[model samples]
Target chain A: MSALAEILFGGLFQGSLYAMMAVGLALVWTTIGVFNFSHGVFMMLGAYIAWQLVELGLPAAVAFPIAVVVMAGVGWILQASVVRPLIGRPNIVLVVVITTLAAGSLIENGALTIWGPRSKQIPALIDGNTTIGGVGVSLHQIAIIVITPLILAALWMFLNRTRLGLALRAVAQNEDASHLVGLNVTALYGLAFAIAASLAGLAGIFMGGYRFMSPVMGSDPLLKALIVVVFGGISSISGPIFAAYLIGFFEAACSYYFGLYWTPALLFGVLILTLMVRPEGIFASRSRGLA
Target chain B: MNPILTVEGITAGYGRVTVLHDISLEAGRFGNVGLFGPNGHGKTTLLRAISGLLQAKSGRIQFDGQDISGLSARAIVGTGLIHVPQGNRLFPDLSIADCMALGAYSPRARPHEAENREKVVKLFPKLAERWRQRVRTLSGGERQMVSIGTALMSHPRLLILDEPTLGLAPKIKDELCASVMDISRGGVPLIVVEQDIEFLLELTQQLYLVNHGAVATEIKPGESLDHGEIMSMYFGH
Candidate 1:
């Protein structure tokens, strides 16, 4: 039925956004050995930046890219000031968790204060809807579905083919050896954060195109991204991506059949079962491999 | 002429536990030196400090006439000191070919990437056959070959190997020793640490006995004592 296609397409569309956020989360986790708790806030900030730019009369095309660039800078700054300082300490992991969690809270509260908690939305990049097989679909949804895979492929190529990406992978695998092999590891860490932020920012822009985004809108997606990253192996880029879409489809199906209210419970139940069976992860590699 | 690399009265260690105490050693312009000692006696720590993974708390390190006591590990590697650390510590997920490319990541080594890669493949032809294999899948000896080959791709002016043949079958160890000899014959200097006195005697011109985190004795391997005598000397038997 066309209704089936609609759900599938809807799942794929939402899955694309989840993939973007989770991939970034996974990259930062592997690189810095710290799970950036502010990752979701970065998404919220990106949507806000794009909204502000559009408010200043910049078109969606210009605003989205500018927001991504700005988010890259913000990511680098976050790593430098917030993350980099705490590396090599005795209790770095614990310290970083607390610090980043506090930083996320501060940024969220600050955004709330500045943006006034008003729900804002960006006009869709292309303002049109079309029916395919008697199921109505928005053009932006199709665009998101098409665009995400290409971006992920580009990322894969960068990681597997380029020398810089090789260095990032190397750092993730054995940081000491990466430095011993003459990599500028600090710079690579900064790059990982920057790239992750850009990806998260794009996800935010895509989200704003479809739904009203408030400062707190990121928390839900953040939780979803966490699930995706865990479901996928955090050690590799492609793992989180596949898991993201799979989770997205699961969410859609559960919402449709089990009712929206029961979706969360079912998701958590399945996640718990999956973990109980395979505590490492669903896509876990035997050894850490960033690519 | 000044020695190629010199450590003058260096004191270094991990956090709060001092290991190398007032250790001083030097390598000639174009000769291999060996260090042998009991386990946990600071040979690896000395290599770590010399390679810039650890800082000398109370002395100076000069490499090719440049003062390099407190330089970062990357900087030291850029200065053409390549260390293939102990225990095949490598990025297990990377393919052998990828490891070779990454070894030449420093600007100083980039220019020589092509020839160095050729040399590594030629030195360890087994590595060439499994260019796309992940390091984790490789056998122990094969991983060691990849580690050393990866180091060779760095165009090292000075190559340091910590227990290059620590654990392997005798036949594989022989092949590795021959390959290392070939590397040395090709004119790259070596600072090797090993437990096999026969291997050390064959490889190094001079040997330093490290004990209690200091150089306890310096002996020319082919000079006065036999290999058994030297082993006893190192073990303090």
Candidate 2:
């Protein structure tokens, strides 16, 4: 019983981080219609930025927001330079592939240029441990779990209630229609990309404190985010958040009962099954509304 | 009356395939001009050219006595030329309010977003009723209303509607046509493209009959031909 509780707690906490990481990739894909490969690199870049701030003796709270801002700026620059020119071009597959390759190259080269191939661990923001139903849990881990859902709720409100959010949703649905409605589509695209990068930066910040930072740290979150986005539905924001929780819990259970190797296998197995059964995704059925 | 829009020797195409050849039309504020032709006759293409969705290979377009041939689609939209594109092109996954809000996407429309939104909901009261409802859930006619209302948000000087009544029931078509008339009456120059000459003949003053990417004739409907003759002319013998 204690073991189950421990596993569930751990999984849910890890999944929250996954949700943050995936949000950016899903956003870029939905709004801009580009599966930005550079999404993971953005995460890496964010983590590094936060880590550097810490090295500069800045507090974690200040560093985190600054990292997000920097990442957003980076995202804007990337979209302006690389993504804008390719808009309305029919070759979406090539664009996606190019972005993915570009991201990977950034990661490999960036690590060498900046961090010098060394893995760095961040000092946990919330140190010490707590017990949940007689199961030991770190305060930092619990904070991560609580914070993920909080961010999700905030994001939900932001998208539904804000003018900018509504515009982004419109662009995601139909770029041409958004344009006809007098939307500055280019600006909207830049804004969406920025939001995505900010999310990635936040995720990276958490990743650093939770474990360690390195160029290779990006792949784990990226893969997890990919799964969450697919599981949630490419078009739905709420779907990804829910999918993250589910995947997180599942991963926790599998890792506890089986082993580390069985975790990926089980996740992949479930992902495959879900893909075969509901390719549009689990949340997609309920979200059949307009763009 | 001063011409609100003037197209002189405008030629346009997608890729190497030319769709409009020397196609030109002129209109004044409150004027409703109908482009009557069969499918593939370049009516939509001409509107697209005017809207800057497609560039004119060789031509000049003057809107309100200013050359606007070099503007991008976004820029042209900013100049009060709102295009309600063919096919119920609403963002299917978005809500009614969001769909209507998109009409205020240009800089000129931003300041009047609140006023325009109120006007849009008032015009299509169905949209106001289902303001929170997703666009995909609306009936085809409701979606059409939203589309028209969306275009109107820009306070358009010139409104170009492509196949406004396409795939609609006869009753719905009548309602849409009435709305178009109402919009034109409100001091916006309207260019309507329709396959049905009878509909245009009833709704508009001047008609341009297009054939093989060129204007076959520019005439008044009630004068030179009856409804049957106009149909035969557009559809051919």
Best by lDDT: 1
Q: How high is the TM-score of chain A in model 1?
A: 0.97
Q: Give per-residue lDDT, candidate 1, residue A179.
A: 82
> Which candidate number would show the highest TM-score if scored against the true structure?
1
Please provide TM-scores computed only on chain A for all of the candidate models, following their numbering.
0.97, 0.94
DockQ of every candidate: 0.85, 0.62
Instruction: For residues A24-77, write the lDDT of model 1, one tens digit per residue.
Output: 988988877888888898999898999999999998889899999999998999
What would the per-residue lDDT of candidate 2 be over residues B7-31, giving only the tens digit for each residue? 8989999988999888877865335
Please report the candidate that would top DockQ against the real structure: 1
* lDDT tens digits, residue span B1-237, model 1: 457899899999888999999999898643799999899999999999998888878899999999888999999999999899999969898999999999999999899999989999889999989999999999999999999998988889999999999899999999999999999999989999998889888888888899989999987534746877886886688
Q: What is the C-alpha lDDT profile of model 2 across A137-217, one tens digit per residue?
A: 788887878887888778778777777788888878887777677677899889888988888878877778877688877
In terms of docking quality, model 2 is medium
- Candidate 1, which segments miss by more than 4 Å at Cα? B221-224
RMSD of 1: 1.4
